[model samples]
Target: MLIVKNIKNTIKYFIIILAISLSLSIQTLKAQEVAIKDIYFHTDISFEFSDTFGADRYNHFHEGTDIMGEQMAPLYAAVDGVVSYMVNPEGSWGYAITIKGSDDYTYHYLHINNDTPGTDDGNGGIKNAYAEGIERGVSVKRGQLIGYMGDSGNAESVGHHLHFEIRKPNNEPINPYNSLLAALNSEEYNPEIAKELSGTINDDKNIVSSSESLCESNTLIKMADYSTVYYCGADSKRYIFPNEKIFYSWYDDFSDVVILGVKEMEAIPLGGNVTYKPGSRMIKMQTSSKVYVVERGGTLRWVQSTSVAENMYGEKWNTYIDDLPDSLFFDYNIGEEIVST
Candidate 1:
């Protein structure tokens, strides 16, 4: 009887292990089904978003996928869908396109030159469609030639590339890279991608070859808080500047906290010549445009006010000190606040 009981116990353990293994295999297969639209060589051109964008702050999460391509690389429709709504709200997206997929998801294409030809009913094609929509005000369809690629709108500083976003039925953005994994023939390139830069200083110098080769040696610099400063030349090679004391910090991804000043220093006005305290913590960029008073005692808290030096994305900050002064300075100015607040 004891021998029989031992046999049954072993079988039960084997079944449990089998179940766990099967579950993991199913998840892996699901991951493999993601489709990849285009396979561009990954270069440290400074803006390839990863699947795990905010791992350090909020554990792990990503919003979109960026395809590396030339200025006007044609973006094909990943799947058939109807045009939903198109808007050039702030001209930040240059000319933008939005499509609703059969899967009840909406795909957004931002930073296009203008609508593609043959989109409208002929009176106004892509141009008229947007114009009419703006006049009459309505959402527009899939497969419509919304616009061509151009370095327009807010992404002007960055190189000309398409900013594609996938949203669920409820409009939550998902990582575009993962969405295309299953549909492509080539395996996803997980190796580090880089760009090369090399040029000589000369007046009207004749060039032989503009680009050399894309390799893995491209050094990446994450410039937030107070990281490192990199210099790029016409040669396209990036050389790191050492001995520069840059500062960066890690904070909660969803925290609306802004650093007012170095710990124990009086709040400085915007545009005023200022200096940091001995132990000041330089502030990182955030999403909102308001200057906030954050008092850090045993717990950290923030009070939003109007006292902002500049406005970004149409958000204005202009108020006065309402909270008690605390230690640490946040240097998140220069009009690049993260907009997840």
Candidate 2:
């Protein structure tokens, strides 16, 4: 009887362990599916938008992005989804359509064109507004053309453009300017799924990276006996400078890197890479031509126009550019494009 009781207890413990393992596996799969690298947003269009866009009403704020494009320009599905809502005639949203993606994100395409192609008569009707066979409950694939830009609803006099909005599963809005840019430059390579650590006491612990240098920075540090430089962030972790360009972007010279023993450095752990300082320099991936300026934190804002760049940084603005390594692109997040000086 005791043997049987022990056997039953062991089986129960084994079942519990299996259940925990299954739960972890499920969570990992979900994380992979929702990673930022896997997400896509554009089918075929290039337009400007800003997360700071505040197209406010008398009392309401902008809940979606206003994508500046030509009147009657083609509009495509931002994701693979089923059309959930459509409003014709003239409401506040004008001719609008909403798609609910399988990822649980809701894509709102509002203020679609409702006027004649060349006039703002507001009589284009459903045929001019929606794509063929597009209606509520219809399935649509990403980049599939479903409508045209319009001056419908409250935007009758404002201009012709598509007001695109992305809503989370809870229906809250996400600032989609960056995501739209990502979709616009869809050919850009995605970051690796696995990244190796940059700084740690490797097998040759005595000489870190074969050199140690000091610099002027807010919170820079390094192993007292080694040469690799790190930025001691306010978050209490050390971040690698990666290269001289990144180092000089934040400081002029190595006159201030705090040195501590390996024992002291190990206590801080590793944070990541120290991004270029805001307003210090412009950057672009070695493989891409898009120039960007560093904003506060790791936000990378595109230098949208040559004139804007020259106006802000001078006629020799191109000289300020630095080639950011593509592998390190994931270290920063794209922000609103700099359209004006």
Candidate 3:
């Protein structure tokens, strides 16, 4: 009886210790999660991100997140860190700046516009704190304007965007998406400024017009054939639907079908049209050359537009479709010239 009691007591003590250790570990991990104040500030109201971290680049992995913005848009320091390095290379990364934050994470800002006299690498560049007082070894405060967005180096052909990255102390890349999102949704984020810049309000959930509100609720619907699904918003004034081509593989021959995993529906006013500008997320395609027409309420149909094709693919956009195998071109009439609005 004594031996059994001792064994039971030992097991109970071991379990208690294990639980305490686990609790400490979880607390440590939560503490390690980066906070918004540890990075730069956003002066622009509208925030748009293109390529996400961990995306597949041509032959390598994309180590950073690309924030899409117009040329000369302001770029600020994410945290209070010392400028570790600044270089104007000719090819990849163009004019770049790196700061080692006090939090022991390194922040990278790449492809800044190269127009500033002293900072210009002759490709594209911007003047940052290095001109004022923040150079290598110089400390910087969070939200300090470091440079301007630009299309320098290899990005000149791709247009203007800031390729931002966060790295471990040892230089290993970590995903910056969560950190960026946190900053965008924090109290410091200004919705009015986002509206003024992007003409929209970006919340933690989704993008909506500043004048509009996110649907407080949702309802699911299935088509008569049960082949399609749609989400109805609580407003009763708008409905959200999936892109048909994406959901149904309507044009499998031309390109691979891309399903945007949009779980929540973006609320739209009833009977209003949703327009997509160049580089908008609404424009879904495997490549820039192959364009699809997306209609209101989530219906994607076939339409032809010479101007859109030319703008998207220059003058030789048709070559992309011509290269498709004949067997894959069965669905649409090849000669029909249906103009897209």
Query: Candidate 2, 94: how far from true, in Å?
Result: 0.9
TM-score of each: 0.31, 0.43, 0.42
**For residues 106-225, what per-residue lDDT tens digits would candidate 1 score against the true structure?**
777676544333222112224322321222123332112233344446655665666667677888565566544432322211101100111111000111111332211222222245
As for candidate 2, its clashing pairs are: 113-149, 113-150, 211-227, 212-227, 214-254, 214-255, 215-254, 215-255, 215-256
Tens digit per residue, CA lDDT, model 3, 24-101: 754453344344434543424365874355554675567778888777676767877788988734345577788887
- Native-vs-model 1 lDDT? 0.36
Question: What lDDT does the true structure give each of the candidates?
Answer: 0.36, 0.67, 0.50
Please give me the total number of clashing residue pairs in predicted model 3.
11
TM-score of 2: 0.43
Name model 1 segments beyond 4 Å from true.
1-62, 88-90, 114-146, 186-341
Give the distance in Å from residue 184's predicted Cα in candidate 3 to where it truly belongs. Answer: 0.6
Candidate 2 at residue 303, lDDT? 77
Model 3 poorest 10 in a row by lDDT: 200-209
Error in Å for residue 184 of model 2: 1.7
Q: What is the lDDT for 315 in model 3?
A: 74
Q: Residue 260 lDDT in model 2?
A: 79
